[model samples]
Target chain A: MAKRFSAEKYVAGILAGDRVMLSRAITLVESKLHSDHELAQEVISQVLPHAGNSVRIGITGVPGVGKSTFIEAFGIYLIQQQQKKLAVLAIDPTSQRSGGSILGDKTRMDTLATNPQAFIRPSPAGKSLGGVTRSTRESIILCEAAGFDTIFVETVGVGQSETAVHAMVDFFLLLMLAGAGDELQGIKRGIMEMADAIAITKADGSNKDKAKVARAEYQNALHLYPRAASGWLPHVSTCSALQQQTGLNTIWQTISEYLQLTRSNGYFEQKRRDQNLQWMYEAIRQGLEEHFYNHQQVKAQLPDVAAQVKEGKKSAFAAASELLGLV
Target chain B: MAKRFSAEKYVAGILAGDRVMLSRAITLVESKLHSDHELAQEVISQVLPHAGNSVRIGITGVPGVGKSTFIEAFGIYLIQQQQKKLAVLAIDPTSQRSGGSILGDKTRMDTLATNPQAFIRPSPAGKSLGGVTRSTRESIILCEAAGFDTIFVETVGVGQSETAVHAMVDFFLLLMLAGAGDELQGIKRGIMEMADAIAITKADGSNKDKAKVARAEYQNALHLYPRAASGWLPHVSTCSALQQQTGLNTIWQTISEYLQLTRSNGYFEQKRRDQNLQWMYEAIRQGLEEHFYNHQQVKAQLPDVAAQVKEGKKSAFAAASELLGLV
Candidate 1:
């Protein structure tokens, strides 16, 4: 709907760190129109040379876990203390009603929203009949090309979105509440083990002792897990954005130490390289499956076939073959 | 390669619980020849009507976790105490070397291997250039149709195979070694959460106290995880396949309780149905990717394209588009 621009202009603007043009280009990337898609691809290819400069971190917690406040504190700390320009994006597939998220992303945290060093975008409502077509991975590239040295991909921890977030980010940060009562709150089955670090949010007041105990428990629990592929051990820390942002510096230091160790061992670059190939294969799989499932014949027959397979009237492989045969 | 029989005969033999015919059918399913594949499909379809009657359980542990001994004890226990016919199959993709596993699965478990009420099959060595082409899933169907009351899919703990076994089974049993030093020994990242029950193996002699402590610790750890989708809490127990088979009776009792609870609440059938649909989709994805990657044009260009993408010389999506275009 906005004025169209040439791919070269968009590429130059993003590589030169022009925020206005970068925002407009992201809109183009998120656009569902066919022409817009072509323009976005062209821009992406041109800017690919300048991307991959930022550290991509994925943050997640249950809704009540003070995610917005933690992000605000963390983002501000990065800007003021670390001198890093930060871009925060989200991968919420369920956010189909785009307007609410736009308002929430911009206004959820007061200081970070207006900070020149922070570029915050809500989850893109690219919910087409097919699916969310505007990939968060592409958005990460766009932000990196725009000269953001730090990137955060925030996802609600209760859904499958964390897996997508995990695949794209270099380090995953999981926020949790202290105490066992909240164990069932705001997390999925395999997510806790995926964390590069666990930060117990709201670790002030009466909860401070509880938070410390929780940290020790979680650390022991995480230690029981086998080593992560990167050879970095996941630790648990206690922090409260509400109370002087305690333990914030430790979080940053831990990350810096991880960066130093992984970079020294060459896992940082190796992981990124492997991630690139992984995403390529993932994209191919997603594209092929989308094409198959969205075919007219499949759209009509899937429900009946699924029901039959579910009811044990037909076998899974046979039904799958029937669908593939139609394709 | 041997004489092929009619699908009708194979199906009849399988449904009639003929062990010789069942072994031959499983052999046919494992055959890599093209004609064998078609016949396997026919036999699978014909037996589909009688499949899904057996209680499928997945058992996993590291090499040192007494998996073979535990399975032997458990298998014999089921045969003599519970009067259940059991079939054991494995999903070791690396079992192509085959010698070590044969020694472990057969010779290491002398009594169970000789037990008339049990059928044991080693992992297929169909590790052709394509990798693990003979599916254990098809073998599961053939075994089930052969009137086995209990099915166990055993997997080496520290690999991708556990996820495959987890997907097909109704209950997942993970074996763990006692002591904090062995914390990283048998456990993988998310495998603990996937377990319906965890048995601390080798819990006899001096390790008994440690195993009991471990049982409590693991029980607490398992409790900290969010409930599995099935709504059944994961239980932790201490078992010594070596001594008195002390906890073996409890394992059976736990499984019996699970079966009673789930069968009554309808989650059992619902989960099986869900598993069927999930596997169908997974099979489709695997098939589609296999077809694409195996294409002559795609194969020729894939390595160069993959290297380029991995080296950051090309965008992943763009490289994917190039390869997909070839396909």
Candidate 2:
């Protein structure tokens, strides 16, 4: 087990922009121990006042989409050019099963890892989606309290983690390869609708022309979609991490424009407030389901009841009623 | 209250194709009384063995998209031309707030309503989405057992009801107008991906060319989406209910082909099994939330706690933890 600290000490350290204390507090948040949970909640409550001051951006793409490289280049640009303190975190619930996470190797982003203005934390291993999401959310608050002005929560694009990431972030950016057909199959449906912007990665050299075609195709496709409640039309652009100046500036520019629009329109604050309420309800749901499913009677009967339900031998509502009656 | 019937009587009446008993049983399913709920579950369980023999289809479109006329024409075609017993049901959870429902006026589908072979049931008057979804799901079973070989579950395309409808159907058919841009805004995001087929409605007269264009556009757009798990690519066709032969047969043919493909590939049965299990879990979730929110302490403290979470004065997770502790 990791060493622990008082909630006050952790809060003070975070507010003072002490990275070591922030990391320790995050460790406590990720820990599964009951005692750690209490301490983590306490620390989170104390630091909550200092949070919500940063822009949380969710970045996702399928495995071969150059996510790490993009983040590396983007992180450097943010710190050097934009004069922003950036923190990178990930939510990879499948990491334990996959034996490693997308951000597990810090060397993938060696330069950014070494940069003092950027903080990068890999996804916690051996955790469920709920656990990872909760910790990542708390870690964002801790990072914000520690003086970071920008946050990027990364997730593998082909999984359920994107929805969780989308819920927590102020903006959702999807990365895509140039070719739309074969490579597009790797992305899940409904994801396109959630994206605030689509970035066509590896848009240099031979891929440049193909990237432009894909961008136009995606732009037209997005136009067919219903307008987002935020009233912002999703933007599609091409960028290359190798040639940092090519589309990186455009990408950041788009984000900044989005921030200005949403903030001025009051959507940014309204969305954040809605997100806050949504998470509380989500957590309550998780807690209730956990309690019900973990009940000895429910646990024993669920398999049988579920089997009956699957076979259509029992009405799902009646079966559910029977199970709920148990606890 | 309507006169009560024994569970065996209801089951026998349903299996014997008594429409009056089927309607009464549905009324019991839609009731809010504790006694009616108990009786409804018993009837559902007894009739469960006679269910699952129908092709349950979900049809949805925005308000101005000729949904009622299309369903009326489609229902007549299924019953007269195809010689199939049809049950048409609506799931308008917004009925209570909207002052009336899309299907509330039987005159909207006068011909279908008068047909001896067709069963038309409007959305229950005043119920939560959960309540309507559960009762509608049960009503489908009742209709199936009453010898209806085809079921059409209709919903206005602009709301959350489509997801519920999608979860309960074998094939989801989305209706659209010839002109896609202006009218398409009324559809909720993610609804297009859920469709098994998109029917461009009102293809008669001057709308014919526009409908053809819309069909091609949607077909091209659907190709960019990740292939559905059913291995059936969604089909897009133009239809005109006014001129019944225009595209109605093509729509039915597409549905028939989808049914053939999915059934042969085992996706049809697999999806039904998954849906059954999904509804069970959905019910459990609803029950848990209802119990949690109705707790005296939770009911008293939720507004204050929620305001704090919404204002960022408390971390959502921490607030959820506090509320969960009280319950």
Candidate 3:
């Protein structure tokens, strides 16, 4: 049997900026055992005071959009040029069955992975079921407490997880390919609106002109969408991650301006506060669902009843009542 | 003291197409008292078999977009030409504070209100407390049982209620004006993508050219959006609610076409099934929050903790934990 972890020691180690302690705390958070959960909550409570100081950014793009290459160069730029400590986290809920992290293909981000100032943690099992995302949220606090000032959460563009990532991050960056109509065909429309910025990746050599054209087109299309509550208009730009001198500086500048405007107007703080309330409600909702769906009767009857619903043999409300009754 | 209402009486009356009984059943469902809940559930269970026969449509637009007039003409057309019974319902969460239904100004929809084939229920109090929407969903079932073949759930353009209205309806329509940019200035961005059809209202008289131009522009803009899962491209058209021979027929035709495409492709039934599952979960989430927030300790501490969170003196997750701990 494994020895029990001490919550107080974990808290002290994390607040003292120990990376091993941060990793261990994150592991505790991600654990599903009841004892681990109690301890994780305790550690999270103690570390809460030292969190919320980081600028959390969420980046997403569909497969084949050069997300890894872009993140590699951008992460390097932040470390070398801006001297910022960065943490790159992945939120790929689909990876659990595949036994791989969404960022398991680490060769694409080799340089950043080895950087002393950068911390890259692949999502364990690509995804966790139910309350698993609660761990990811906690991991953010642990990272922030350990002194990572710039945090990036990455996700694939073609899934519902973008909304989850959007809720946890301060800025959202969407990557797009130049003149790739097929790529757009696979992307979800709602993801586009959630993005705080869109960057056309791989804008080098022969792709430069097409990337420029794509940038202009996306800019025009974004104008049709309403301005964000923060009064910030999402920006579109082009960058080549493979270039010796990438266009990372301009991207950082846009982020700086956004932070300046929103922070000065108090939108940033207000958004974070709203996010907190949202997470609280979300956690409560998830707990309720787990309890209801796990009911002995509900588990036994769901499949047959759900099939009846799909065949239109039963009204949804009636079916709901029948299920709710069992609980 | 009034005699307790029998669930069996309400169910029988609803199945027999009694409007008064239907309204009473709805009232039972909407009642917040714990005593009414079991009876309401029983009544709903009995009425469920008679429901699911109606075509539900959701209509939304800013206040000045002539939604009432449009519905007035549209409802009349359905009855006179299509020979369909219609029910117009409103979901106004904000109506409570204003002391009336958002659509309490029924004079705008005078013809529809008085028409024998039409049943128009002004939203009671414009909104209710937690799970008010659950009752709205149940009211939909009662309306279907009462033999209304067409259902329209209307919402204001500028609020969060549109998402709720969207969930219960089969088809969503956005009513826009020829050049009402100011009216749309307050509208949110995602609502545009939710529409199955966009109608440019007030197309008669001097506004004809502007309406046509707006239609073309919107048509092009719709093309730029990712295609809806149903594979039916949202239609854009002009309509004149005040004109004797109006463009209402074309709008109906577009809706018919949408229904045909989705029905043939099986997306129609699938969407409804998904919506049912969604509602089940939504109901569960709402229930959990009501329980937690209503906890005596939580209710007492919420304002101060929430204020602290808003002021950035506390982390959101930590504040949430404090509230959750109380519960």
Per-residue alpha-carbon lDDT of candidate 2 for residues A59-172, written as tens digits (9 for 90 to 100): 998888999999999999999999999999977766785434666458899999999999888876565788889888889999999999999999888878899999999999
Clashes of 3: 1
Off by over 4 Å in 1: A1-4, A32-35, A93-97, A102-104, A125-134, A180-189, A219-231, A242-246, B94-96, B99-104, B125-134, B181-185, B242-246
Residue A159 CA displacement from its true place in model 1, Å: 4.0
Q: Name every residue pair that clashes in candidate 3.
A: B92-B126
List, residue by residue over B1-327, the lDDT tens digit for candidate 3. Answer: 224578888878888888778767777877778788778778877777788899999998888888888888899999999999998887776667543476645777888888879888766753443365677778888899889999998887766777887888899999888774542464565687788999988888899999999999888867876777899899998888666345888889989999999999999988888887777656655655666778899888888887876565565556665666675
List, residue by residue over B1-327, the lDDT tens digit for candidate 2. 679989999999999999998988988998878789888999999888989999999999988888899998999998989999999888886668542476645889989999999999887657689888899999999999999999999998987889999999999999988775754466765788799999988888988998888889889878988778999999999888778875889999999999999999999999999999999999999989988998999999999999999999999999999999997
lDDT of each structure?
0.82, 0.89, 0.79
TM-score of chain B of each: 0.93, 0.95, 0.92
Give stretches of model 2 more than 4 Å off: A98-100, A125-127, A180-184, A216-227, B1-9, B97-100, B125-127, B180-186
* Candidate 2: C-alpha lDDT: 0.89
Q: Report RMSD (Å) for each prediction in the order shown.
A: 3.1, 2.6, 3.6
Candidate 1, after superposition: displacement of residue A277 in Å? 0.6
DockQ of each: 0.53, 0.64, 0.28
Q: What TM-scores result for chain A when each predicted structure is judged separately against the true chain A?
A: 0.91, 0.95, 0.93
Report the error of model 1 at residue B88, Å.
0.9
